[model samples]
Target: MEIKAKQLDSVNASAHIKIPSQELKNEVQNLAKKASKTLKIDGFRPGHVPVAVILKRYEKQLQNDAEQNLLKNALNNALKELKKDSKELVGEPYFEKFDKKDEEIDIEFILSFKPDLKLDDYEKYIPQYSEPKATKKEMDEKRKELLKTHASLEPIKGKRALKEGDFAKFDFEGFIDGKSFEGGKANDYVLEIGSKQFIPGFEEGMIGLKIGEEKDLNLSFPKEYPAQHLAGKEVVFKVKLHEIEELKIPELNEELLKKILPNEKEPNAELLEEKIEEQIKNEKLLKLVDEELKAKFADALIENYNFDLPKGIVEQETDMQFRSAWQNFSEEEKKELSQNREKAKEKRDSFKEEAQKSVKLTFIIDGLAKLRKIDINDQELIQAIYFEAYRNGINPKEHFENYKRQGALPAVKMALIEQKLFNDIFFFSKTNKKGEK
Candidate 1:
């Protein structure tokens, strides 16, 4: 087997592969011998047919199979040789032609390879981030929310009107145009007044209705309601209020504080303030770290390189992104997208350059991993797999093995590499926000 390559473009190259006649003959003879044992003929028993007749009968099919095998082998060998000479083959090589018209089979490949990149200087970085500081007001607010979460419900006093945050139980029946519709009646339904849980004006109409009070709820469904038949239709609900209750938040005493924060030496305002401030500080620190990392990573990428990206890779990425974006849209939104197809196309076309940059970044990162001997340990991989599976509600071990089996291991490898690279850059880079004191 021999391969000859010619430069077609910055991102694409054409290769002509040739398989020797001797190799083709050997493959045909081997396949014919294997078929002779099972092939049946009118005049001869199985395995007794002559090789020449077998060749004559199955020549076309055998030749096709042999040619496919030869092409695959030659492509693999050619790529391996190219990688040895130039280590920038970013993605898979695509085949353009494979022909076996005669003894010497001819094959052509349009390879999508990476180009050279020379990063510009990016040692100086100016970061931007918010510095959050918790005050006494913020702490008190959090404590108030905590008290509300642990609140107790109390029955309302006699002859009192309903109010917001008050729980009520009632029986009601709804009528539309003097006819009662299905799912229009309920008994002993529990509702929170002013929650707006029911249709527009339904909850507001329930407001001010006391125990054992009977009234009418006049409301109209929204125009864009889910039920097409009843949407925008006016309906009257005959209300009968049975019982009402009010919520009473508990006092923030030592006992309540102990229950919430166990093992605390002192459960008071000062202790609570310290805890809230610590939590806020940690949150701010994590957020700042993330923002800094992203800013630094993008700067590093912009500073380090420029290259002509593979058109096929960018097109593939754009299609993937379009599918993802389309899947997130509703049926009505899909129709809207159809109407504005040109606008959507414009957005995709704009993303092509960014996608190309991303592809080149991926290739460079992979190259860096090889150069620096960076790798993910088994424990780290197992933990990552566990986190992914737990988030998606799947069996961790099974998910990990499935990804490995499906040839998605490279994705995991790249993720690990990118994480490491980002961390390395963040630690080494001198970063400070513009307004930091």
Candidate 2:
């Protein structure tokens, strides 16, 4: 047997393997000898079947099995010679070409692997971003929102039409072509006006409607509506007003303060204001760090590191992303894609670059974490799990158990490490700039 491996690209390789026919013949003969002892023939006792009869009856089968075993062993040997474990390979080796001649069996395979990444001065590539701060207006709005949550809803004093910010209970039946459709009828549904919870024009049409009054709203469904039958169709919504309730927000006074801070011996407005400000700042900072700054830093890192991505990983990631995006498409859009193969292929191809970037960034971050010795210890893991549970309103113990059962603890740990690494890098960059000044 002879093997030659060549690097096709940074992340891919091609291997040519040749096995001499003599070796295959020898393997087949050895296998036949081993099988003869266990042979069961109607005309002969065990271990007494003629070798010629066995060869004549199962020559092709024995040869094929021997060929398969030889190929597997050869591939394993080749991988060992390359100093790569099977786990390091992406996807299965793709057979590019194969030929069987009287003298030798020749085969070619294309193998994909994770790319080697090299980063120079990676710290300098970390993008600088200003920490977000909450404005007074935003704080005031948050305070008002808190007050509203504590507020009560009261029935309108007298006969009056519903207005924005009023809660209404109403019955609605929608018709297309004078026939009611599925999911188009509801009775006594309470909705907050101006909340935009209903379809476009449905909520706006309910405004100014008095109790016990009925109105037919002529509206057209959006072109991209999820329901295929109703998309872009004109419909009539026969709405009947039931009751109107107005919100009565409590003022930020002594009674409200005492109620909110029952544990405080003497709750004061100054302390409350300071607490609210701090909460707003923390919220703003979290959003900035999680959503904006982290993404920018990742993008900058990706831009700075140039490396070939494993083709198999990029393809799989692209398909996964495309499936997720496809779930959000309107029925008509999906049908169109189903009908046009080229259009669907184009759409899937469009996600390839973004998928490559995402996959490449994952490896880069993982390598950086290892190089920097960033790790999530058991205590940190517990704290992270509890923090996640608190954010998601779940029991920490149950969440940890679920993660463990799903074998997702490693993924969680990796995410925590990446986040900590980025935070540290950001802090170091900021402090270094300050020191330079």
For model 1, residues 142-213, the per-residue Cα lDDT tens digits are: 778778888987888888898888999999998999888888899999898877788888888888988999
TM-score of 2: 0.64
**Backbone clashes counted, model 2:** 0
Best prediction by TM-score: 2
All candidates' TM-scores?
Answer: 0.61, 0.64
Q: Point out where model 1 deviates above 4 Å.
A: 5-14, 18-68, 83-91, 95-126, 135-137, 172-186, 220-238, 263-267, 278-312, 321-351, 360-437
Across 1-437, the per-residue lDDT of candidate 2 in tens digits comes to: 99887776777777799999999998888888878889898898899887778777899999998998898887787777676777879766777689999999999877778767766467665555555567889888988988898899899989988999999999999999999999999999999999988889999999889999999999999999878889999999999999999999988899899977788899988878877887886676566667776787788888878877776677777887999899999999899999999999999999998998988888888888877777789999999999989998899999999999987797688788888887666544453232211
lDDT of 2: 0.84
Cα lDDT for residue 63, candidate 2: 95
TM-score for candidate 1, please give it: 0.61
**Local error of candidate 1 at residue 264 (angstroms):** 4.5
